[model samples]
Target: MHWQRILVGGTKGAGKAIADRFLRGGGTVIITARSAPEEETESHFVRADVSTSEGTTKVIPEMLDLFKGVDIIVHNVGGSSAPSGGFITVTDERWQQAINENLFPAVRLDRGLLPSTIERGSGVIIHVSSIQRTLPLYHSTLAYAAVKAALTNYSKALSNEVSPKEVRVVTVSPGFRETAAATRMFER
Candidate 1:
């Protein structure tokens, strides 16, 4: 499946790995993140804060320009900056941050890109979710888990809506991996 042009939100950790795989398979990979990846990859990095609408707005033109348009989208950006306390300690601000980081990027990107994909009548969307969505660790990742739950449900609904249009939407729920964020969480 050579998608030719692919867009991946969050070009770090698992996102980078996925982009690398696509690049190795001869696909053009464009990756977005607040900062560059730790190391160089075959992917073209688009530095944008995907946690905000402004950032996503910034990305759309660049992405469209990069490859004319994309055929595949991987929504992989997610994390929490809130203090790792129980539910009482998790503030409203933190909850919103989780939604911004984990959920809205996908929503906004789909809103922006899916039109072209639908017009082409062919594309794939992979929403990277968390196992925590079902098996939560409330001590630290409650907000992330809850937002991912919403994302997973939304992805499923999107699959239902878009599959009929010939755009395949899939959600990939991965278990814990030792990314830098996870290392930080463990250190905390």
Candidate 2:
């Protein structure tokens, strides 16, 4: 609960809220995104798209150097950028993008940071999945839902492997919330 070091994988929406909460609780918070947040904040900002390998590379070393490791790592980056009209409408590129955004970031971050956590013998990894994983809206979120399901599975497997080492991996599947991204999705 009283984490001394925290890394949030995104700096907007739920990710931003999580980082802010930790910062208010006096934790040293580090947040990453493809772009900086529109407003200023106290958390250490790392501008990197963690969905990609390059982005994870850019973030991991900096965080390891600065904090040695984090006590809590929240994988809070995910979304669907594909168009509407169900499975046939979603292109291969869009599916890959969905996997990159929804599944791979958490995998990469855990791969990068979990070693330190295991070494220290304690840490928590939180994956932000989605309710769409179970109740998929085929019209637009097919790829998103499928990838989130994969994320949930991955989180469970990771938890089994790491729990013995004193690391906790958790998956939180939240329903829709009216964030800026969700608002845009609805408007479209």
Candidate 3:
């Protein structure tokens, strides 16, 4: 594989699956989340909420020290925490939280780590957006969808800027999945 070092921003759901695939391919995988996974894994686990500046600050240094730089970075940490009502129910704080969770981490991480990838002149950054960005359930995920739309746009802009430097930026927007977080969202 061209990618020897990989960083996955979340390790509980889709992110875990991505990390597992890379690990099975013999790549060194580093996975980060707010909490540890329920089961042990081969990938290096970094417990940090990348949604917060402090969390990103903690994880970036560790990642740089461990791999010097990574070959691939999967921005996979995102979710909707707003209540199940429409726009009126979502206050400013909730909207901001949604943006913080669904968008800022990737922006921050890319800002912190892209220099290394650009210096190498070869790397890939994948932003895991959501299908909801285009077809959204406004009652439950309005803020999430909005931020994901922003994420996809940011990914495209980042790609245009970095592709010339040989650092590829791509966005993947997947449909619904059966995960603990999804289950909770359903229950809400």
Candidate 4:
């Protein structure tokens, strides 16, 4: 039997890239998005917001049933909201949304799924964080930076908890990729 993996991301573009790469290497990949994809392959898509607990809870069970639990989890979901103006113009709701979007999904997914990874004692989990999390692009991204910082620290601490038991938890903090979001940010 082949090992299965899951890629959790809000937008499927980057996650789909990762999944296709993995699928080429022989592992089955399950994609989780707000709307499931119609593609027929090992790339199984499930619709779940994930930024909310309800969404994450609703999706994890279906995944467990499909693949008998994932051997790897790539937490590729993250993004920022708010206008081009500085911090002064931003509202509390956007700040809250940033935290919920960039951080909570990983937390919820790991909380619900890590137990199985621990039980198997052999899985690698990667969280796609952001360098703005540390560098702080300022203005609109300040809150995003702060939340991702919290997420990085949380991931590090969680690694300590699970690493000793054989699960590898690591985070990849990316700067601006030339994706649609970055292009728009540059244009603004």
Candidate 5:
């Protein structure tokens, strides 16, 4: 059982870490982000914005073309776009963007790709959610939290639906990581 194939959908941060781990484990990984990197690498990186339907449509075909199919999908992309002040500073546009970036990608990807994996009767999906979803500090991330809550609920229901079919759906929630971006936010 050589599980040497995985798909990591996210840019930078924890997502990159997950992909790197797969690579180090001798697995072939395919990654996607809003923009392609300047240089090429072993992993197939595609420029995709799963926040939009069009973006999803574009990426799915390219993904199939590259990996044929993946046994694991680790969704580690998500963040808050609302200002740090609180809910007041969060505009409607920002709210939507938060949901788009944090929730839509996973939903769309599962919709587009999970069927085949289900048909084959084996697959694993790991959704990376933030601890903010369950614990919040009353900042602009309220919308993000709500979206993630929805994601968790959706994941539960979806998992139940696919479990009998041999598809496994799991969620990974991370606390405040000491990353550069997080450090900057703390500095502010």
Candidate 6:
């Protein structure tokens, strides 16, 4: 089925790649991020931090108004700012930040938008995760790994809950790619 309105949760990395393909397919795409995309895209841009409920609240009304309704949601926002240390060295704030960044955006967006999808009896929600979730690197990615693991499980559980409603939920756990961040990591 052709998706008329698509919402992409992040706009500067893998999310941008996804948005580009949708735009190329003649779909109306809206991409959100805390800042503007470094490169231009055909998709509509919304500036909001999806990691926080406050940010999602700011964008949801505007998005629904503009698109009228969203048929597909691609949640691709996630990252780790936690310092490189074992779990014992990680702070409470860092753990919360990990959840906020990697997991909560998808949770909040789905919470806000899934009802509409249910009412329509059709929709798709794709959560992009990382392999680190299962094969964790405890030194630098302890918190990120933990939250992504949560996100993976949440996606699966949400799929089970929503599938009967005719809403399709998918979680994609991809290995490392040569994104700017990964490239920088290699250079370092």
Model 4 CA RMSD to the hidden true structure, in angstroms = 1.8
For model 3, residues 41-99, the per-residue Cα lDDT tens digits are 88888889888999999888987887787878988888987899888899999999998
- Candidate 2 residue pairs in clash (backbone atoms < 3 Å): none
In terms of lDDT, model 5 sits at 0.75
Candidate 5 runs further than 4 Å off: 4-6, 37-40
lDDT for model 2, on a 0 to 1 scale? 0.85
Report the lDDT tens digits of candidate 1 across residue range 1-188: 54645555546677777777777788677878888877768777888887899999988888776666688898888887767787988888989999999999999989988888898879989999989899988998889899999999999999999899999999999988989888887776
Q: Against the unseen true structure, what C-alpha lDDT does each candidate score? A: 0.84, 0.85, 0.86, 0.81, 0.75, 0.82
RMSD of each: 1.6, 1.4, 1.4, 1.8, 2.0, 1.8
**What is the Cα-based TM-score of model 2?**
0.95
> Which candidate would rank higher by TM-score, 3 or 5?
3
Question: Cα lDDT of model 4 overall?
Answer: 0.81
| TM-score of every model versus the real structure | 0.93, 0.95, 0.95, 0.91, 0.89, 0.92
Regions of model 4 farther than 4 Å from truth: 38-41
Between candidates 3 and 4, the lDDT winner: 3
Candidate 6 achieves a global lDDT of: 0.82
Off by over 4 Å in 6: 5-7, 184-188
Q: Which stretches of candidate 1 lie over 4 Å from their true place?
A: none
Q: Is candidate 1 or candidate 4 better by lDDT?
A: 1
* Cα lDDT of model 6 by residue, 1-188, tens digit: 65655555546667777777888888678888888877867778888888888999977887667766688888888887666657887899989998999999888888887887788789888898899999997978788898999999999999999999999999999999878766654442
What does candidate 2's lDDT look like per residue over 37-136, in tens digits? 7788888898898889999999889988988888888888888878888889989999999999988988888899899989887988989899998999
Cα displacement (Å) at residue 115, model 4: 0.3
How big is the positional error of residue 118 in model 2, measured in Å on the Cα after superposition? Answer: 0.7
TM-score for candidate 1, residues paired by index: 0.93
